[model samples]
Target: EDQVTQSPEALRLQEGESSSLNCSYTVSGLRGLFWYRQDPGKGPEFLFTLYSAGEEKEKERLKATLTKKESFLHITAPKPEDSATYLCAVQERKTSYDKVIFGPGTSLSVIP
Candidate 1:
């Protein structure tokens, strides 16, 4: 079975503060790792797709990196508008569809 765990279930930061969220996972026949940001009552918005170890992607104040067994979402100089729940998911090499497993998520609150 594939599984994902995120640390610091919730985080509070002052404006301009920076932090990192961790996503640890274990999966067989790894295919890809995904990062997303979700707002209250909204679906997750895709942020990145990491296909292999050492892969990384960035957008605005967010950066996502992947390794063999984990991934990180680094937030730099975050603002109140950046506050949201960040999600991490993984897709394994499987024949069936909907093989992606999502982590509970890290809820971030940036106070202005």
Candidate 2:
């Protein structure tokens, strides 16, 4: 069975603070790892895609990296506007149909 877990289900940070959110997983075969940000009452916005181990992607104050069994999202100098729920998802190569398993997100709150 494939399973994904995230730590510190919620985070509270002062403006300009930096932190890293962790996502650990176990899958039969990993095809891709994805990162997304979701705002209240909105759909998730794609942040990054990692195809293989050691792959990484970055956008503004966010960086996403992948490994054999886990992934990380590093937030640098976050502002109040950066507050959102960060999501981690994975695609399994063994599945016949395109199926992505998502982890419960890490909700981040940045206080100004």
Candidate 3:
């Protein structure tokens, strides 16, 4: 079975502050890792997809990077609008199909 863990369960940051969120995983075979952001009462919004180690993607103030054992989502000069729960999902390679495993998620609060 594939498993993922997100660190700091929750984070509090002042507006314009920057930080990095962690997502670590363990699986038999990894297909890819996905990043998402969810606001209260809304479904997770797709952020980035990483296929292999050393891969990176960015959107506005958010940047996601992947490694062999874990992935990181870095927030640069974030604003209150960026405050949301960040999630990391991993797709495990299966014989017939792919199984996705999602991390618990890290809730972020940015105060102005």
Top candidate (lDDT):
3
The Cα local distance difference test for each model comes to 0.93, 0.92, 0.96
Off by over 4 Å in 1: 95-98
* Model 1, span 38-89: residue lDDT tens: 9999999998999999988999999999999999999999999999999999
TM-score of each: 0.95, 0.95, 0.97
Model 3 lDDT at residue 103: 100
Q: Predictions ranked by TM-score, top down?
A: 3, 2, 1
lDDT of 3 by residue, 12-103 (tens): 99999999999999998989999999999999999999999999999899999999999999999989999999999999998999999999
Flag the better candidate by lDDT, 2 or 3. 3
Please provide, for model 2 over 1-112, each residue's C-alpha lDDT reduced to its tens digit, 9 standing for 90 to 100. Answer: 7888997799999999899999999988888989999999999999899999998888999999898989999999999999999999998876467678999999999999
Q: How close is candidate 1 to the true structure, as a TM-score?
A: 0.95
Q: Which residue pairs collide, candidate 3? A: none
Which pairs, if any, clash in model 2?
none
Clashes of 2: 0
